[model samples]
Target: MSRIAKRFAETRASGRAALIPYVTAGDPAPDVTVPLLHDLVAAGADLLELGVPFSDPMADGPVIQLACERSLAHGTRLRDVLAMVREFRQTDSETPVVLMGYLNPVERMGAEVFASAAAEAGVDGVLMVDLPPEESDDLTGLLERAGIDPIFLVAPTTADARLSHVAAAARGFIYYVSLKGVTGAQSLDPAALGARLGAIRAITELPLGVGFGIRDAATAGAVARVADAVVVGSAIVRLAEQYPDAPERFRAAAAELAREMRTAMDAARADAAPAAV
Candidate 1:
Protein backbone atom coordinates (compact mmCIF):
# COMPACT_ATOMS: atom_id res chain seq x y z
CA MET A 1 0.00 0.00 0.00
CA SER A 2 1.03 3.63 -0.52
CA ARG A 3 2.08 5.73 2.43
CA ILE A 4 -1.28 7.46 2.44
CA ALA A 5 -3.18 4.18 2.35
CA LYS A 6 -0.93 2.82 5.09
CA ARG A 7 -1.45 5.85 7.29
CA PHE A 8 -5.20 5.72 6.89
CA ALA A 9 -5.23 1.99 7.56
CA GLU A 10 -3.17 2.42 10.70
CA THR A 11 -5.35 5.24 11.95
CA ARG A 12 -8.46 3.18 11.30
CA ALA A 13 -7.03 0.19 13.15
CA SER A 14 -6.35 2.43 16.11
CA GLY A 15 -9.95 3.71 15.88
CA ARG A 16 -8.93 7.34 15.31
CA ALA A 17 -9.18 9.73 12.41
CA ALA A 18 -6.03 11.02 10.73
CA LEU A 19 -5.16 14.70 11.01
CA ILE A 20 -4.19 16.18 7.66
CA PRO A 21 -2.86 19.74 7.55
CA TYR A 22 -2.56 21.99 4.50
CA VAL A 23 -0.08 24.82 3.85
CA THR A 24 1.13 26.68 0.82
CA ALA A 25 4.65 25.63 -0.16
CA GLY A 26 6.19 29.07 -0.64
CA ASP A 27 3.71 31.26 1.18
CA PRO A 28 6.04 33.19 3.49
CA ALA A 29 9.21 31.99 1.73
CA PRO A 30 10.52 28.99 -0.12
CA ASP A 31 13.20 28.21 2.42
CA VAL A 32 10.73 27.79 5.24
CA THR A 33 8.60 25.16 3.49
CA VAL A 34 10.52 22.03 4.49
CA PRO A 35 10.88 23.02 8.15
CA LEU A 36 7.20 23.90 8.34
CA LEU A 37 6.30 20.52 6.87
CA HIS A 38 8.42 18.73 9.46
CA ASP A 39 6.90 20.83 12.22
CA LEU A 40 3.39 19.82 11.15
CA VAL A 41 4.26 16.12 11.15
CA ALA A 42 5.78 16.49 14.59
CA ALA A 43 2.54 18.09 15.73
CA GLY A 44 0.57 14.93 14.82
CA ALA A 45 -0.27 15.45 11.19
CA ASP A 46 -0.72 12.05 9.57
CA LEU A 47 -0.67 13.40 6.02
CA LEU A 48 0.45 16.66 4.42
CA GLU A 49 -1.26 18.66 1.66
CA LEU A 50 1.13 21.25 0.19
CA GLY A 51 -0.52 23.87 -1.96
CA VAL A 52 1.24 24.61 -5.23
CA PRO A 53 0.96 28.35 -5.73
CA PHE A 54 -0.92 29.23 -8.89
CA SER A 55 -1.57 32.55 -10.54
CA ASP A 56 -5.34 32.15 -10.25
CA PRO A 57 -6.75 29.91 -7.55
CA MET A 58 -10.48 30.34 -8.10
CA ALA A 59 -11.66 27.74 -5.60
CA ASP A 60 -9.74 29.35 -2.73
CA GLY A 61 -10.89 32.16 -0.48
CA PRO A 62 -9.15 35.48 0.23
CA VAL A 63 -6.73 33.98 2.77
CA ILE A 64 -5.41 31.26 0.43
CA GLN A 65 -5.57 33.57 -2.59
CA LEU A 66 -3.28 35.97 -0.75
CA ALA A 67 -1.02 33.05 0.13
CA CYS A 68 -0.75 32.11 -3.55
CA GLU A 69 0.06 35.72 -4.41
CA ARG A 70 2.85 35.87 -1.85
CA SER A 71 4.39 32.64 -3.12
CA LEU A 72 4.03 33.69 -6.74
CA ALA A 73 5.71 37.04 -5.96
CA HIS A 74 8.73 35.00 -4.85
CA GLY A 75 8.67 33.00 -8.14
CA THR A 76 7.48 29.82 -6.49
CA ARG A 77 6.79 27.73 -9.57
CA LEU A 78 5.65 24.11 -9.72
CA ARG A 79 9.25 22.97 -10.04
CA ASP A 80 10.22 24.90 -6.94
CA VAL A 81 7.42 23.22 -4.99
CA LEU A 82 8.60 19.83 -6.27
CA ALA A 83 12.13 20.65 -5.10
CA MET A 84 10.76 21.46 -1.67
CA VAL A 85 9.16 18.01 -1.57
CA ARG A 86 12.46 16.41 -2.61
CA GLU A 87 14.26 18.22 0.18
CA PHE A 88 11.54 17.25 2.66
CA ARG A 89 11.85 13.59 1.65
CA GLN A 90 15.57 13.62 2.38
CA THR A 91 14.76 13.15 6.06
CA ASP A 92 11.14 11.98 6.18
CA SER A 93 10.07 9.26 3.81
CA GLU A 94 6.91 8.07 5.53
CA THR A 95 4.77 11.19 5.32
CA PRO A 96 2.57 11.42 2.21
CA VAL A 97 2.77 14.81 0.45
CA VAL A 98 -0.10 15.64 -1.92
CA LEU A 99 0.40 18.56 -4.31
CA MET A 100 -2.81 20.60 -4.18
CA GLY A 101 -3.29 23.21 -6.89
CA TYR A 102 -5.00 24.06 -10.15
CA LEU A 103 -4.08 22.50 -13.51
CA ASN A 104 -2.45 25.51 -15.14
CA PRO A 105 1.03 24.90 -13.74
CA VAL A 106 0.89 21.17 -14.34
CA GLU A 107 -0.26 21.69 -17.92
CA ARG A 108 2.42 24.34 -18.46
CA MET A 109 5.02 21.72 -17.63
CA GLY A 110 3.12 19.01 -19.55
CA ALA A 111 1.22 16.25 -17.74
CA GLU A 112 3.69 13.46 -18.42
CA VAL A 113 6.67 15.64 -17.52
CA PHE A 114 5.03 16.79 -14.30
CA ALA A 115 4.16 13.23 -13.39
CA SER A 116 7.75 12.00 -13.72
CA ALA A 117 9.23 14.98 -11.92
CA ALA A 118 6.69 14.79 -9.11
CA ALA A 119 7.27 11.05 -8.60
CA GLU A 120 11.01 11.62 -8.46
CA ALA A 121 10.49 14.45 -5.98
CA GLY A 122 8.87 12.00 -3.54
CA VAL A 123 5.36 13.32 -4.09
CA ASP A 124 2.85 10.60 -3.25
CA GLY A 125 -0.30 12.18 -4.69
CA VAL A 126 -1.84 15.10 -6.61
CA LEU A 127 -5.08 17.08 -6.07
CA MET A 128 -5.84 19.43 -8.96
CA VAL A 129 -8.88 21.36 -7.80
CA ASP A 130 -9.98 22.21 -11.31
CA LEU A 131 -9.31 18.83 -12.88
CA PRO A 132 -12.59 16.99 -13.06
CA PRO A 133 -12.38 13.20 -13.17
CA GLU A 134 -14.13 13.11 -16.56
CA GLU A 135 -11.31 15.15 -18.14
CA SER A 136 -8.50 13.70 -16.00
CA ASP A 137 -7.82 10.42 -17.79
CA ASP A 138 -4.52 11.37 -19.41
CA LEU A 139 -3.04 12.96 -16.30
CA THR A 140 -4.53 10.41 -13.91
CA GLY A 141 -3.22 7.49 -15.96
CA LEU A 142 0.22 9.08 -16.12
CA LEU A 143 0.29 9.76 -12.38
CA GLU A 144 -0.78 6.21 -11.53
CA ARG A 145 1.90 4.86 -13.84
CA ALA A 146 4.41 6.86 -11.84
CA GLY A 147 3.02 5.37 -8.58
CA ILE A 148 1.42 8.61 -7.49
CA ASP A 149 -2.26 8.59 -6.51
CA PRO A 150 -4.75 11.05 -7.92
CA ILE A 151 -6.92 12.63 -5.24
CA PHE A 152 -10.26 14.22 -6.10
CA LEU A 153 -12.70 16.52 -4.34
CA VAL A 154 -16.39 15.83 -3.69
CA ALA A 155 -18.61 18.74 -2.84
CA PRO A 156 -21.69 18.68 -0.64
CA THR A 157 -23.97 19.01 -3.66
CA THR A 158 -22.46 16.17 -5.64
CA ALA A 159 -25.01 13.61 -6.73
CA ASP A 160 -24.87 9.91 -5.96
CA ALA A 161 -24.04 9.00 -9.56
CA ARG A 162 -21.19 11.51 -9.54
CA LEU A 163 -19.94 10.14 -6.23
CA SER A 164 -19.44 6.74 -7.84
CA HIS A 165 -17.47 8.32 -10.65
CA VAL A 166 -15.16 10.18 -8.25
CA ALA A 167 -14.85 7.13 -6.04
CA ALA A 168 -13.70 4.97 -8.94
CA ALA A 169 -11.18 7.56 -10.10
CA ALA A 170 -9.92 8.40 -6.63
CA ARG A 171 -7.09 6.39 -5.02
CA GLY A 172 -5.72 7.97 -1.86
CA PHE A 173 -8.89 9.36 -0.25
CA ILE A 174 -11.83 11.52 -1.25
CA TYR A 175 -11.80 15.10 0.08
CA TYR A 176 -15.34 16.25 0.85
CA VAL A 177 -15.78 20.01 0.82
CA SER A 178 -17.97 20.39 3.89
CA LEU A 179 -19.49 23.75 3.05
CA LYS A 180 -21.34 25.32 0.17
CA GLY A 181 -19.01 28.33 -0.20
CA VAL A 182 -15.29 28.74 -0.61
CA THR A 183 -12.73 27.65 1.94
CA GLY A 184 -13.15 29.40 5.32
CA ALA A 185 -16.38 31.04 4.17
CA GLN A 186 -18.77 29.20 6.52
CA SER A 187 -19.23 26.84 9.44
CA LEU A 188 -19.75 23.05 9.43
CA ASP A 189 -22.83 21.34 10.85
CA PRO A 190 -21.53 18.02 12.19
CA ALA A 191 -24.95 16.35 12.13
CA ALA A 192 -25.53 17.40 8.54
CA LEU A 193 -21.96 16.47 7.63
CA GLY A 194 -22.39 13.06 9.22
CA ALA A 195 -25.46 12.39 7.10
CA ARG A 196 -23.64 13.44 3.93
CA LEU A 197 -20.68 11.26 4.88
CA GLY A 198 -23.08 8.39 5.41
CA ALA A 199 -24.31 8.70 1.85
CA ILE A 200 -20.73 8.94 0.56
CA ARG A 201 -19.65 5.89 2.57
CA ALA A 202 -22.43 3.86 1.03
CA ILE A 203 -20.99 4.65 -2.38
CA THR A 204 -17.36 3.84 -1.58
CA GLU A 205 -15.41 2.39 1.29
CA LEU A 206 -12.41 4.64 0.57
CA PRO A 207 -11.48 6.96 3.41
CA LEU A 208 -13.41 10.21 3.53
CA GLY A 209 -11.68 13.45 4.59
CA VAL A 210 -13.93 16.37 5.57
CA GLY A 211 -12.44 19.80 4.91
CA PHE A 212 -13.36 23.50 4.68
CA GLY A 213 -15.06 25.47 7.47
CA ILE A 214 -13.04 23.62 10.08
CA ARG A 215 -11.41 26.41 12.10
CA ASP A 216 -10.94 25.09 15.65
CA ALA A 217 -10.35 21.99 17.78
CA ALA A 218 -14.00 21.67 18.75
CA THR A 219 -15.09 21.54 15.13
CA ALA A 220 -12.31 19.17 14.19
CA GLY A 221 -13.38 16.81 16.95
CA ALA A 222 -16.96 16.96 15.76
CA VAL A 223 -16.04 16.06 12.18
CA ALA A 224 -13.69 13.29 13.28
CA ARG A 225 -16.68 11.40 14.60
CA VAL A 226 -17.83 10.57 11.07
CA ALA A 227 -14.78 11.16 8.91
CA ASP A 228 -11.76 8.96 8.37
CA ALA A 229 -9.64 12.13 8.31
CA VAL A 230 -9.90 15.85 9.03
CA VAL A 231 -8.41 18.39 6.62
CA VAL A 232 -7.50 21.98 7.59
CA GLY A 233 -6.30 24.45 4.98
CA SER A 234 -7.20 28.13 5.23
CA ALA A 235 -6.61 28.19 8.98
CA ILE A 236 -2.94 27.29 8.51
CA VAL A 237 -2.58 29.59 5.52
CA ARG A 238 -3.88 32.43 7.69
CA LEU A 239 -1.01 31.88 10.09
CA ALA A 240 1.54 32.22 7.30
CA GLU A 241 -0.16 35.36 6.07
CA GLN A 242 -0.47 36.70 9.62
CA TYR A 243 3.26 36.34 10.36
CA PRO A 244 4.72 37.03 6.95
CA ASP A 245 8.02 38.31 8.27
CA ALA A 246 8.32 35.82 11.12
CA PRO A 247 8.79 32.31 9.76
CA GLU A 248 9.29 30.91 13.26
CA ARG A 249 6.01 32.39 14.38
CA PHE A 250 4.24 31.00 11.34
CA ARG A 251 5.64 27.53 11.98
CA ALA A 252 4.79 27.67 15.70
CA ALA A 253 1.25 28.84 15.03
CA ALA A 254 0.62 26.20 12.38
CA ALA A 255 2.03 23.47 14.59
CA GLU A 256 -0.03 24.63 17.55
CA LEU A 257 -3.25 24.54 15.56
CA ALA A 258 -2.43 21.10 14.21
CA ARG A 259 -1.66 19.82 17.72
CA GLU A 260 -4.95 21.16 19.01
CA MET A 261 -6.92 19.54 16.20
CA ARG A 262 -5.06 16.30 16.73
CA THR A 263 -5.80 16.22 20.45
CA ALA A 264 -9.46 16.97 19.94
CA MET A 265 -9.93 14.33 17.24
CA ASP A 266 -8.32 11.69 19.40
CA ALA A 267 -10.32 12.67 22.45
CA ALA A 268 -13.57 12.48 20.47
CA ARG A 269 -12.71 8.98 19.30
CA ALA A 270 -12.04 7.95 22.90
CA ASP A 271 -15.35 9.32 24.05
CA ALA A 272 -17.17 7.35 21.35
CA ALA A 273 -15.48 4.07 22.20
CA PRO A 274 -17.63 1.40 23.80
CA ALA A 275 -17.04 0.55 27.45
CA ALA A 276 -15.63 -2.88 28.32
CA VAL A 277 -18.42 -5.29 29.11
Candidate 2:
Protein backbone atom coordinates (compact mmCIF):
# COMPACT_ATOMS: atom_id res chain seq x y z
CA MET A 1 0.00 0.00 0.00
CA SER A 2 1.01 3.62 -0.41
CA ARG A 3 2.41 5.30 2.66
CA ILE A 4 -0.72 7.45 3.06
CA ALA A 5 -3.14 4.54 2.66
CA LYS A 6 -1.05 2.44 5.04
CA ARG A 7 -0.96 5.13 7.70
CA PHE A 8 -4.70 5.82 7.46
CA ALA A 9 -5.43 2.09 7.66
CA GLU A 10 -3.23 1.78 10.72
CA THR A 11 -4.92 4.71 12.42
CA ARG A 12 -8.37 3.37 11.60
CA ALA A 13 -7.45 -0.01 13.04
CA SER A 14 -6.35 1.72 16.22
CA GLY A 15 -9.83 3.28 16.46
CA ARG A 16 -8.41 6.79 16.43
CA ALA A 17 -8.57 9.50 13.85
CA ALA A 18 -5.29 10.45 12.21
CA LEU A 19 -3.64 13.70 13.19
CA ILE A 20 -2.18 15.57 10.23
CA PRO A 21 -0.17 18.70 11.03
CA TYR A 22 0.82 21.30 8.44
CA VAL A 23 3.71 23.75 8.33
CA THR A 24 5.27 25.86 5.65
CA ALA A 25 8.62 24.64 4.40
CA GLY A 26 11.53 27.00 5.23
CA ASP A 27 9.48 29.00 7.67
CA PRO A 28 11.61 30.79 10.25
CA ALA A 29 14.67 29.28 8.52
CA PRO A 30 15.19 26.89 5.67
CA ASP A 31 17.51 24.67 7.68
CA VAL A 32 15.05 24.07 10.53
CA THR A 33 12.26 22.48 8.47
CA VAL A 34 13.53 18.87 8.49
CA PRO A 35 14.01 18.89 12.26
CA LEU A 36 10.56 20.40 12.72
CA LEU A 37 9.14 17.70 10.46
CA HIS A 38 10.73 15.07 12.66
CA ASP A 39 9.44 16.77 15.78
CA LEU A 40 5.87 16.72 14.43
CA VAL A 41 6.06 12.97 13.81
CA ALA A 42 7.54 12.43 17.26
CA ALA A 43 4.58 14.29 18.69
CA GLY A 44 2.13 11.83 17.06
CA ALA A 45 1.40 13.40 13.71
CA ASP A 46 0.35 10.52 11.44
CA LEU A 47 0.88 12.52 8.26
CA LEU A 48 2.74 15.73 7.39
CA GLU A 49 1.64 18.48 5.01
CA LEU A 50 4.55 20.74 4.09
CA GLY A 51 3.50 23.94 2.38
CA VAL A 52 5.58 24.92 -0.64
CA PRO A 53 5.91 28.71 -0.34
CA PHE A 54 4.39 30.56 -3.24
CA SER A 55 4.10 34.21 -4.30
CA ASP A 56 0.31 34.08 -4.22
CA PRO A 57 -1.46 31.85 -1.70
CA MET A 58 -4.98 33.16 -2.20
CA ALA A 59 -6.60 30.28 -0.40
CA ASP A 60 -4.47 30.86 2.71
CA GLY A 61 -5.22 33.43 5.37
CA PRO A 62 -2.85 36.08 6.65
CA VAL A 63 -0.87 33.73 8.90
CA ILE A 64 -0.01 31.21 6.19
CA GLN A 65 0.47 34.04 3.71
CA LEU A 66 3.08 35.56 5.99
CA ALA A 67 4.67 32.17 6.41
CA CYS A 68 5.07 31.91 2.67
CA GLU A 69 6.58 35.36 2.56
CA ARG A 70 9.11 34.45 5.23
CA SER A 71 10.06 31.29 3.37
CA LEU A 72 10.33 33.05 0.04
CA ALA A 73 12.43 35.80 1.55
CA HIS A 74 14.95 33.19 2.63
CA GLY A 75 15.35 32.12 -1.01
CA THR A 76 13.48 28.87 -0.40
CA ARG A 77 12.43 27.37 -3.70
CA LEU A 78 10.39 24.34 -4.75
CA ARG A 79 13.60 22.32 -4.96
CA ASP A 80 14.58 23.36 -1.44
CA VAL A 81 11.26 22.11 -0.05
CA LEU A 82 11.71 18.78 -1.86
CA ALA A 83 15.26 18.56 -0.47
CA MET A 84 13.88 19.05 3.02
CA VAL A 85 11.54 16.10 2.47
CA ARG A 86 14.48 14.04 1.18
CA GLU A 87 16.54 14.89 4.24
CA PHE A 88 13.60 14.04 6.50
CA ARG A 89 13.41 10.58 4.93
CA GLN A 90 16.96 9.76 6.06
CA THR A 91 15.86 8.78 9.57
CA ASP A 92 12.08 8.36 9.34
CA SER A 93 10.47 6.61 6.40
CA GLU A 94 7.07 5.59 7.70
CA THR A 95 5.01 8.76 8.06
CA PRO A 96 3.56 10.16 4.84
CA VAL A 97 4.60 13.65 3.74
CA VAL A 98 2.26 15.60 1.43
CA LEU A 99 3.43 18.72 -0.37
CA MET A 100 0.74 21.46 -0.25
CA GLY A 101 1.16 24.41 -2.56
CA TYR A 102 -0.03 26.26 -5.67
CA LEU A 103 0.25 25.15 -9.29
CA ASN A 104 2.58 27.96 -10.39
CA PRO A 105 5.65 26.28 -9.02
CA VAL A 106 4.76 22.89 -10.45
CA GLU A 107 3.97 24.40 -13.82
CA ARG A 108 7.29 26.23 -13.73
CA MET A 109 9.08 22.93 -13.10
CA GLY A 110 6.88 20.99 -15.55
CA ALA A 111 4.40 18.43 -14.21
CA GLU A 112 6.45 15.33 -15.06
CA VAL A 113 9.69 16.79 -13.72
CA PHE A 114 8.01 17.94 -10.54
CA ALA A 115 6.30 14.58 -10.03
CA SER A 116 9.53 12.65 -10.43
CA ALA A 117 11.37 15.02 -8.12
CA ALA A 118 8.64 14.83 -5.43
CA ALA A 119 8.56 11.02 -5.57
CA GLU A 120 12.34 10.93 -5.27
CA ALA A 121 12.11 13.25 -2.28
CA GLY A 122 9.89 10.76 -0.48
CA VAL A 123 6.74 12.86 -0.85
CA ASP A 124 3.63 10.68 -0.81
CA GLY A 125 1.10 13.26 -2.03
CA VAL A 126 0.53 16.77 -3.37
CA LEU A 127 -2.37 19.19 -2.63
CA MET A 128 -2.45 22.24 -4.84
CA VAL A 129 -5.04 24.74 -3.60
CA ASP A 130 -5.63 26.45 -6.93
CA LEU A 131 -5.71 23.37 -9.15
CA PRO A 132 -9.20 22.01 -9.71
CA PRO A 133 -9.83 18.41 -10.76
CA GLU A 134 -11.08 19.37 -14.19
CA GLU A 135 -7.76 21.00 -15.05
CA SER A 136 -5.51 18.67 -13.07
CA ASP A 137 -5.03 15.81 -15.53
CA ASP A 138 -1.54 16.95 -16.53
CA LEU A 139 -0.36 16.97 -12.92
CA THR A 140 -2.50 14.15 -11.57
CA GLY A 141 -1.57 11.81 -14.40
CA LEU A 142 2.11 12.42 -13.79
CA LEU A 143 1.72 12.11 -10.02
CA GLU A 144 -0.10 8.77 -10.27
CA ARG A 145 2.61 7.51 -12.63
CA ALA A 146 5.23 8.49 -10.06
CA GLY A 147 3.31 6.71 -7.30
CA ILE A 148 2.49 10.01 -5.64
CA ASP A 149 -1.09 10.86 -4.71
CA PRO A 150 -2.97 13.87 -5.99
CA ILE A 151 -4.97 15.02 -2.99
CA PHE A 152 -7.89 17.39 -3.60
CA LEU A 153 -9.96 19.68 -1.38
CA VAL A 154 -13.76 19.70 -1.05
CA ALA A 155 -15.27 22.80 0.41
CA PRO A 156 -18.61 23.17 2.21
CA THR A 157 -20.08 24.87 -0.81
CA THR A 158 -19.16 21.99 -3.11
CA ALA A 159 -22.04 20.44 -5.04
CA ASP A 160 -22.74 16.71 -5.01
CA ALA A 161 -21.81 16.40 -8.66
CA ARG A 162 -18.47 18.11 -8.09
CA LEU A 163 -17.92 15.97 -5.02
CA SER A 164 -18.25 12.86 -7.19
CA HIS A 165 -15.88 14.35 -9.74
CA VAL A 166 -13.33 15.21 -7.05
CA ALA A 167 -13.69 11.84 -5.39
CA ALA A 168 -13.08 10.14 -8.73
CA ALA A 169 -9.93 12.18 -9.42
CA ALA A 170 -8.52 12.24 -5.90
CA ARG A 171 -6.01 9.84 -4.44
CA GLY A 172 -4.55 9.42 -0.92
CA PHE A 173 -7.60 11.16 0.65
CA ILE A 174 -10.01 14.03 0.15
CA TYR A 175 -9.50 17.13 2.29
CA TYR A 176 -12.87 18.56 3.36
CA VAL A 177 -12.53 22.23 4.15
CA SER A 178 -14.58 22.61 7.32
CA LEU A 179 -15.59 26.15 6.53
CA LYS A 180 -16.32 28.26 3.49
CA GLY A 181 -13.70 30.89 4.18
CA VAL A 182 -9.93 30.73 3.82
CA THR A 183 -7.68 28.78 6.16
CA GLY A 184 -7.60 30.05 9.80
CA ALA A 185 -11.15 31.30 9.74
CA GLN A 186 -12.75 30.08 12.96
CA SER A 187 -16.26 29.02 12.04
CA LEU A 188 -16.37 25.25 12.44
CA ASP A 189 -19.65 23.86 13.75
CA PRO A 190 -19.11 20.22 14.72
CA ALA A 191 -22.82 19.26 14.61
CA ALA A 192 -23.23 20.74 11.16
CA LEU A 193 -19.90 19.32 10.06
CA GLY A 194 -20.98 15.83 11.12
CA ALA A 195 -24.10 16.11 9.00
CA ARG A 196 -22.08 17.28 6.02
CA LEU A 197 -19.64 14.43 6.46
CA GLY A 198 -22.55 12.00 6.54
CA ALA A 199 -23.68 13.30 3.17
CA ILE A 200 -20.13 13.09 1.79
CA ARG A 201 -19.80 9.55 3.06
CA ALA A 202 -22.76 8.50 0.95
CA ILE A 203 -20.79 9.45 -2.17
CA THR A 204 -17.34 7.95 -1.73
CA GLU A 205 -15.59 5.56 0.59
CA LEU A 206 -12.23 7.29 0.27
CA PRO A 207 -10.79 8.46 3.57
CA LEU A 208 -12.21 11.90 4.38
CA GLY A 209 -9.94 14.41 6.10
CA VAL A 210 -11.43 17.61 7.54
CA GLY A 211 -9.31 20.76 7.87
CA PHE A 212 -9.28 24.66 7.83
CA GLY A 213 -10.84 25.42 11.25
CA ILE A 214 -9.49 22.80 13.59
CA ARG A 215 -7.37 24.84 16.04
CA ASP A 216 -7.00 22.80 19.22
CA ALA A 217 -7.68 19.61 21.12
CA ALA A 218 -11.38 20.23 21.70
CA THR A 219 -12.04 21.07 18.07
CA ALA A 220 -9.84 18.26 16.85
CA GLY A 221 -11.59 15.74 19.08
CA ALA A 222 -14.98 16.92 17.96
CA VAL A 223 -14.11 16.53 14.34
CA ALA A 224 -12.33 13.25 15.00
CA ARG A 225 -15.65 11.68 15.92
CA VAL A 226 -16.83 12.03 12.34
CA ALA A 227 -13.81 12.37 10.07
CA ASP A 228 -11.04 9.94 9.19
CA ALA A 229 -8.40 12.62 9.78
CA VAL A 230 -8.20 16.02 11.47
CA VAL A 231 -5.78 18.48 9.91
CA VAL A 232 -4.43 21.36 12.01
CA GLY A 233 -2.58 24.05 10.06
CA SER A 234 -2.90 27.73 11.01
CA ALA A 235 -2.66 26.93 14.71
CA ILE A 236 0.74 25.28 14.18
CA VAL A 237 1.89 27.94 11.74
CA ARG A 238 0.97 30.51 14.34
CA LEU A 239 3.46 28.82 16.66
CA ALA A 240 6.23 29.32 14.12
CA GLU A 241 5.33 32.98 13.89
CA GLN A 242 5.14 33.30 17.67
CA TYR A 243 8.70 32.06 18.05
CA PRO A 244 10.28 32.93 14.74
CA ASP A 245 13.70 33.69 16.18
CA ALA A 246 13.75 30.52 18.31
CA PRO A 247 13.37 27.40 16.20
CA GLU A 248 13.65 25.06 19.17
CA ARG A 249 10.88 26.92 20.97
CA PHE A 250 8.72 26.75 17.87
CA ARG A 251 9.18 23.00 17.60
CA ALA A 252 8.43 22.55 21.29
CA ALA A 253 5.25 24.57 21.01
CA ALA A 254 4.13 22.78 17.89
CA ALA A 255 4.86 19.34 19.38
CA GLU A 256 2.99 20.13 22.58
CA LEU A 257 -0.12 21.19 20.68
CA ALA A 258 0.04 18.15 18.43
CA ARG A 259 0.42 15.82 21.39
CA GLU A 260 -2.54 17.41 23.14
CA MET A 261 -4.72 17.03 20.06
CA ARG A 262 -3.63 13.44 19.58
CA THR A 263 -4.46 12.60 23.17
CA ALA A 264 -7.86 14.21 22.92
CA MET A 265 -8.72 12.47 19.66
CA ASP A 266 -7.70 9.08 21.04
CA ALA A 267 -9.76 9.65 24.15
CA ALA A 268 -12.73 10.69 22.06
CA ARG A 269 -12.38 7.58 19.97
CA ALA A 270 -12.33 5.37 23.04
CA ASP A 271 -15.42 7.12 24.34
CA ALA A 272 -17.19 6.32 21.06
CA ALA A 273 -16.03 2.70 21.05
CA PRO A 274 -18.77 0.10 20.77
CA ALA A 275 -19.59 -2.00 23.85
CA ALA A 276 -17.96 -5.44 23.90
CA VAL A 277 -20.45 -8.24 23.53
- lDDT of all predictions: 0.94, 0.94
Clash list (residue pairs), candidate 1: none
Question: In model 2, which range of ten residues has the least summed lDDT?
Answer: 268-277
lDDT per residue for candidate 2 within 31-99, as digits (tens), equals 989999898899999999999999999999999999999999999999999999999999999999999
RMSD of candidate 1 to true structure, Å: 1.3
lDDT of 1: 0.94
Off by over 4 Å in 2: 275-277
The positional error of residue 71 in candidate 1, measured at the CA in angstroms, is 0.5
Candidate 1 lDDT for residue 91: 100
Instruction: Give, for candidate 1, the lowest lDDT window spanning 10 residues.
Output: 268-277
